[model samples]
Target: MEIKNEYLRDLYRRVEKRDPNEPEFLQAVGEVLQSLAPVADRRPDLIDWGVFERIVEPERMITFRVSWVDDQGKVQVNRGYRVQYNSAIGPYKGGLRLHPSVNASIIKFLGFEQTFKNSLTGLPMGGAKGGSDFDPKGKSDMEIMRFCQSFMTELYRHIGEDTDVPAGDIGVGAREIGYLFGQYKRIRNTFTGVLTGKGLTYGGSLARTEATGYGLLYFLREMLQKMKHEPVAGKTAVISGSGNVAIYACEKSQQLGMKVVAMSDSAGYVYDEKGIDLAVVKQIKEVERGRIKAYAERVPGAVYTEGCKGIWTIPCDVALPCATQNELDLAGAEALVAHGVMAVCEGANMPTTPDAAEFFQKNGVLFAPGKASNAGGVSVSGLEMSQNSMRYSWTFEEVDRKLEEIMKGIFHAAYTAAEEYGCSGDLIAGANIAGFLKVAESMKAQGIAY
Candidate 1:
């Protein structure tokens, strides 16, 4: 599993010298470089055509000021950004994350991951991600509306149905998408499908919210079956990030007979020895918009820890890191392995760092990287694009079924690729190799764009 990507190494050096502060960007490059190991070992055309270098850097990364007035009449300025990573296959498509951690590095990592995640879904969508540093929590609807409107005012000119289509991520949800899409419509005066995660009344697709989480479980199920691992029945699992991905992953895992004992947010984590109460979690996160600490009050015997770390140390057979990027570092991963975690699936993109990923692989743990495991969200996003293009929407069951199938197919692709590359059990390598091959072939076929 040696990576011969000399070009990737060179690009990494240049970018490292330029942006030393952007760990997310470096992590994204590292994951891609890990994937390109097999490709670089096998392909000279890719090296000669500069495919390794060009794809490492985004096609365009736009930053702007999102200036809006709060309810207190104070002018609040937050930075907004969009990274169009690649589009050799189709229009740019990814989610918009509005966490306070929003920056060029985070967005670039998400967008870079999106490139292959979308490609792995067998969809014709490229990768892009945008977000603002504006925190939606504790903000009134009016203030949030003004912020979305301002963000979209400039972003509208760069995106459309035929161009880049964005969806909701960490801090952005149906509410944010509704506001952003409303502004787009008001400005463009066209009822086109410019965004995927819109409200149902405004042409949004069903099952989109459950796509990523459920898709993660589906992929994990396939992995378990292929590897002849134990069924999820009676398994204890820990999930971080009580957002859409964590909640849905909790739901599907519960249905599949896994007990999710822990879930977390940026502020902290909640652990219920009897498995998380999905209803309570949804109420706190989805409706009340409260922190993870609130779950302790409603659920008996549940305790809330004031940090995202060590939530992984609670001893679980399955560990799903649905939190933000690199939330599961080497220490956390070592803890999970020490606790005898048999399976680790990423429900969040790049949630595990390279060192952690290598630790899991080296320790013989079944690892599903974000590119392969958490791709359900963008795969459903691609489904939304299809429904929009055809002027129709599918039923929830239909969409869910398609999502499960897609996730399973992606799992098989990685599984098969791993076997072919002689890294049969190294799914991290398999996924990176599989996803990179898809974009690489497309990049080569498209030839030099300049």
Candidate 2:
């Protein structure tokens, strides 16, 4: 372990050269480097891609050649990845994503972000991310099953109930989890809780489906209740991405008496003047498994647009970007401010760009960064781990209550850390600094690993 600032620069250079234009990767790495600088100074020996950087990268980023037989028996070979990024805090825990955008850089970036996010939750879960380049939208069920089996064949060796637990992400859901879990059981010769997001008949948590969305609103409630600032009820809200996170955000917000004006997918967004109908939207998304275009058809008088960027243009007091990384840009931030947006809580990881985040802070918006807001999903996953170990089940209300308390505590921790660091009103810095401090302190106390 050598503490050389130049080594970090070299690591950044290598990543940048490989990615070239991945702003998200660069931004995430930059934040990590910033957080680790103090640690590097204190333990200069742990520098230069030492245990820290290597752990920051991945213990093993297994990219295997997955060839599966489709329904027609035509063999399809897709690149699959599982970034066992960091296991210092606990076993590797993250999600499996499947989309055209899946790649090593993206997976690594997400895994890196998850390390701190998991740590901040006070959960004994490390961070990892796995996914494939296969899109499940057009794939037949048989084809998806084959692909999942193929994926689990390689993923089984590196994961276990006490080792690593992967969950659902953008493209992987109930069906995919079932397939993967089945494969894991067949390969491991045991029925264990090696994965979260399992079917209810299995070891999955009850409220895991609605965890992220509900947890986000719970965090927002705490953020709003600070100093009795503002209530989400009666507030106009906009959410991006018509997937699980977006749909659930709408459901919870409506329950809290908010006017959700719009929700969107990659194709576009649907905006209704008189608050979005949660049941219809959920049917269109969670049930029908369709795009937001169908949303306008189901709900009369609602308009759907093709480009998702314009989603932020609609006026709202609150905006929840549950879509993807960097979905809300600087212009979107300005638009939200212009429309009198009071708060922006992220239900997705790194949904706001650095510039957009800075713009919101400069304009006085209550911005709960993704790390604090979207932690509900993983926090509950940790709870599921407990239930699995104890061989007991908790009521949905009980799990939801624990989620609410954790979200509130995370929000408060970040807020108080900001206050202590004299970084008032700047949540991005507060969150990044606070989240990293806990992990960094733990890493240092553990001493260097050979």
Candidate 3:
């Protein structure tokens, strides 16, 4: 990525040299820095204040070893990490992903992206990400419980409601959250909002499970109205992933009169000619914890295909890559462009690669980056934090309405920022600039750390 501003170019080069092996982190840095050239040119004092340089580096990175005993009395070990990227506006807020793929680079990438995503929500939440390489799949409840206890044993020392709050991601969900929260409570001896995505019986807020998916649609609806004066009604949509984000995204899109034709899991994708049956999907995924192929078996007129990436090859008016980062590559973007995709809004962090995102923008696809489009989860997490502070919880309708309003506010913030920066309709740039400026201003106000 070429940054036009001389200062930003130098900073990018320095980051590249410092972390050459971290492709994901470098990719995120490149995207944000490239979009920031315009801001850098206008506010050269940012360079003088070392905001760009400092923001790229995490405030703290903690790595630890997690060891636990399995059901067979076998010892299992995994690595855990938390990258507290930034806390200028507020305490660190992000998700904890547990999977075999967890590593320093991936956590850094996620943490870096979370900084801007939290910022775009217009809430006083900073950014951080923590996770372990412990795979929770196929583990017995007691095994998972023991692992969560061991992981939290070291992690509890670094987190708090006001300092840093970690929620679920990837392999981490409500079940895992229950175990982790139980252990945290046992060790800390007090209940606080140290974690989001808790059970409703506890400090958890309503609408959190549906926040990201519903938030994505809310942002997309706003984008559609602004660009085409339309809604998602009667349109065909393709979404990747069968997790919480994809499942609820299907529900919300269906409720809005859109036909979601396909959804996927890691192993494969299931395509239905008619709109997907949300009830059946919920039963298979949420209830049975089965793979997506089971959806094809249970529902008629649906075909199961190997390889989840093939989901993108199916044509649609809209595409939501709710899966992992870089899932939608340049080829996928080209296919979507070829299929006349009107818009693409990400429901996952950095789901679209840089090349693909630029292709969509150049071809006038009304693209929205994850930072702006997927801030709803964190927005409501912030709401959960607020509720935790007040010892009160809002109703589902109330939280959902607040999330919709915040998504609209984020869209306008990014959109207006893009227009101001002379990059109208380029939400990728708009979001980066909007989020960067807020953090930059805060960093400036705080003065140099050292």
Candidate 4:
């Protein structure tokens, strides 16, 4: 793994030395750095200004303690963090994941990725990510509310509508967002649109829940049509994760005349050769708040498997990893390629390992990275910000249409950028180059600042 640019290599070495134990952060920085060779060759002024060095470091990193009482009348403590990674383009924008895996490295990686993801939307947004090591599962509503309040009590000081806006992620959904927003309002005494995933009655945008999944399919469809001279119709798709992204991706796939054969959760994956029943899955995972095992038990033709990773082995024409970071490794990519997968699109941030992504590319799989493919969530979040600012809402069709257009724009921008850089079909480099150039230019215009 040798870097081509001497200055870029030096910057990366500094990052590695400064955060040796932060593998997630290192991996993210390494990937972005690897793609900057084209930019470095074209923009030597950026190198002279040390843009790479400054971009790798966050504008601010805030960490605080969150202490709440559970239903058992015991005081529980958790750590919370928010990494305001970069704000060259606009205010910091990203999600907050309230999982036990929340850490500095993970938050930094997500924020670093968000910087580009937000830029790709062509919207005025920077990058930031925050979360606590708090697990909302098995907690009562009141318990969750108390925890959200505690988390927001310290977080409110660091965020605002025009400053840094945080939205929902893994464990942070509508329920948590409502709680956090209420707490922020209570503390700040302001009803500004500080959060995007609010209930529709309170300024949330429509089609947000389905944005990431639907957006993923839109981007994938365009890629398939351009590269393979076909649409998703009649393709058997294997998707990981049964959450909002996967469910909506499945819905969009079915609507596009494609059949989704598999979807998974943390416990395991379910495979149905006749295409997944999105209705049954929604009822189980959303309404019933149950694991995917219930889906297998209730669905007529679905088979349940034991582990999440094995979902990749299910034969399909397309594969969507919407589960979590690094969920799909070389083995999973190899399995999909071996099964003749035509395309691999990421619905989760950094879901596919670098090697896996390269493997898919080398094998002629039309691979779309999460930043470009699964950007619908934040793209709609940006729209939600607009609706909130205008104090108006758009119809579902309106927002969905706008989302489709944005995804298409993102694809062409990345596709063309890759082709321009003489790496046609290499969306990994294309997306990185496209997004990096946008933020880099913005940073340059703003002048160098510590």
> What overall lDDT goes with each candidate model?
0.88, 0.83, 0.93, 0.93
**lDDT per residue, candidate 2, 124-208, as tens digits?**
7888888999889888888899999998898898889888899999899999999999999987789888889887888888899
RMSD of each: 1.6, 3.2, 0.9, 0.9
Per-residue error for 15 in candidate 4, Å, reads 0.6
Error of 4 at 154 (Å): 0.5
Tens digits of per-residue lDDT, candidate 3, 1-450, equal 678888888888999899998999999998999999899889988889989989999999999999999999999999999999999999999999999989999999999999999999989999999999999899998999899999999999999998999998998888899999999999999999999999999989999999999999999999999987887898899999989999989989988899999999999999998889989989998998999999999898999999977888898999999999989999999999999899999999999988899899889898999999989899999999999999998999999999999999999999999999989889999999999899999999999956
Tell how far residue 25 is off in model 1, in angstroms: 0.6
TM-score of 4: 0.99
**lDDT for model 1, on a 0 to 1 scale?**
0.88
Residues 223-256, candidate 4, lDDT per residue (tens digit)? Answer: 9998889868889999999988999999999999
**What is the number of backbone collisions in each predicted candidate, taken in the order shown?**
0, 0, 0, 0
